[model samples]
Target: MAIRDDYIKWVILITILYRVGTTNSVCELSVSHGDKLYNFSLASPTWKYPHGVLSEDGFYKIARNGTVLWFQLCDGLIFNHDPPRCFDCQDCGGPSHCGMGCSALVANPLGGYYVCTTIGRSSSTKVNLIDEKNPSMGVVVKISSSGVLTNCSLSVSVFCDSNGLQGPNLLETVGTCDYATVLRHPSGCAKTVSLHGNGLGWFSTLLIIVLCFFVAYLLAGTAYRYFSLGIRGVHAIPHLEVWLSLPHRIQGLFRSLIRRFRRPTQGHRSTYSPVNF
Candidate 1:
């Protein structure tokens, strides 16, 4: 038999005003932030939930159970958590929200809650190549923080999906960091989130289907009765009493009809009349 296309539905993908580090949660606080191996991830808080991953290989949606559901492979990141600096963007336009290139938004490498300026971008092609061949087994993009981000030389912290929070990449400020401090998504990370099923919607569709079948059966039965037995035939049916009575209405009706058609009569005249005797 030809294999039917198996469908597993899930919701994934979102464009960003920031990097994958852009988030508001505690756990995903990367002990930094994996893989030309094409690993996918989101910020820490998302680890307990389902999430999406974009790679040169393809877009894969991880189930809440961490099952890798296949998606299509094409150019570019599906969810660019990294938004480009408005003016600093090169091919920047409506399509360049994550910046004109692949940008990395690292968490405060210097420590404390501050959006990292270590964030930068490089050509997509180059970045993909870096992701493939880098010693860290991750991509290496250009540093375009323009000093908003510190140029780090230390191993930056990173996270993974299959694995929990960990540090693989490095960040060295050369002793500088973005002085601006604000509550920002912790970074030097990637994540895999489990996407849950649309239980409610799926059940609702199933319920509707079952109800439809029941209604169809009722209609079919009614139609058959109408075509086979006309209105007069319906009148010949037993009354409600037949359904709920000691003596059925059908039995009484038959008895009454028989009595109405039959009358008492002499079978034969007497052989001798009184006059003849």
Candidate 2:
């Protein structure tokens, strides 16, 4: 990180040369919250133009809902139209299974599994985390609901996925998410349970609809033809009745015509009759 000449005055005004370590130098910046001032360290092993933006490994941004830590920027709108990202830690605020933080059956950092910190909830609970732009030296401040300011790193165990960079003053950090064991350790917070849906799939729904239609067709023909269901002084569906009685009606009409033709007619019953033709 390199500091430019333009920002020199601001750096001097912001920090008062807090500490000068032999190996790694550290500085302090005061973050204002209303009437109070919160100071966090800005440390780096090497120097670049005296002062600059403290980046990864020395400066980390910390955010949490209850016990779970967060590191990634929740994606913007356009995914399922839901405002919250899948890995959002805000969901873990309350003491309930719904507060398991993230839900992923696998180890996917985005949405594959949930990385939770709790005690005695379960031994098989999965841990999923999101740590992206973690600062190395700078401290991230969090304000409680009562308007009191707090450094989140001091109280919560930051589940980091970085390469060996532990930000200053983090209470406890399980360096890699993989380092967090399932039931191997406890953080006093209880594990949250996740529920999944087992509803019918597309194939099942289609199959059910088809079966219903087939059953309805069979029942309509059989029941309506026999019972008639008090159907009297009203118009009936034409094709329905025809479809029901077509076989019997065709046989009856054919038999009547045959008998008429076989019976003696005017030409056959002629008075002289008996010609030897």
Candidate 3:
């Protein structure tokens, strides 16, 4: 009973670990697309400055027409003061809102701030991120969010650059609310191994762990039986009877199945058949 309980405990541990390791999180920094894996783990919200932007304050800023934009890459924007009020402003100040990437302060006809849009939410990375349409062009990390007040949506495209660590470079603004940008970081480059495909996948790794645990269980159980229980010879092996009988049990099962499925044999044919037509 103790050995069986040990076996159960090990199985439960493996199961929990497998589920936690394999489940995808909404804010995963690494994504696998096609044959290559892109990892943005290096890019986090803790950066002192936004990529490519030279600002004493920790965000990239852009002004076009009457609208001003503040944004960050792989992080939420930092503000010294409260941001302008907008429909999405209620959810502002966090990664799921204006902080995730892009926020816009739009000007009204009367010259007052009209609305704000939190264009990129970190939580959307898992669902919206995709590989570049052209592999040769390199990886593109696209993140977007539906507007809180307007019909428009906001998007930011992060391109791969070998030197992108300086931060992301804002390339252009689309219409009144969207953005295009480039990030030249090594993480954007293609990887030979996938996020889960590094040497072995989660399933394979778990399988190996289970096998190791099983072997350890056998060894430990056998030793206990030999020393503590005074079991002798082959009988000292833990569950020796079960192991020894497994082959014969398997054979019996196969034979039973075969008998169930096999065609019935006809009665022995008469050595001399009756005269045939």
Q: Which candidate ranks first by TM-score, i.e. highest?
A: 3
**lDDT preference between candidates 1 and 3, better one:** 3
Cα displacement (angstroms), candidate 3, residue 177, comes to 3.7
For candidate 2, write residues 164-255 as lDDT tens digits: 33342332333322212111111111222223245688999999999999778766755674567544332233256666788999999999
Model 2 gets an lDDT of: 0.32
Q: Which stretches of candidate 2 lie over 4 Å from their true place?
A: 1-155, 158-199, 227-277
lDDT to native, each model: 0.32, 0.32, 0.52
Ranking by TM-score: 3, 1, 2
Clashes of each: 39, 16, 6
Model 2: worst 10 consecutive residues (lDDT sum): 72-81
Runs of candidate 1 exceeding 4 Å displacement: 1-41, 44-215, 227-277
RMSD of each: 23.3, 28.1, 20.6
lDDT tens digits by residue: candidate 3, 47-133: 433322223364666555555556543344556654443444554553334443333323222335455555665444432344545
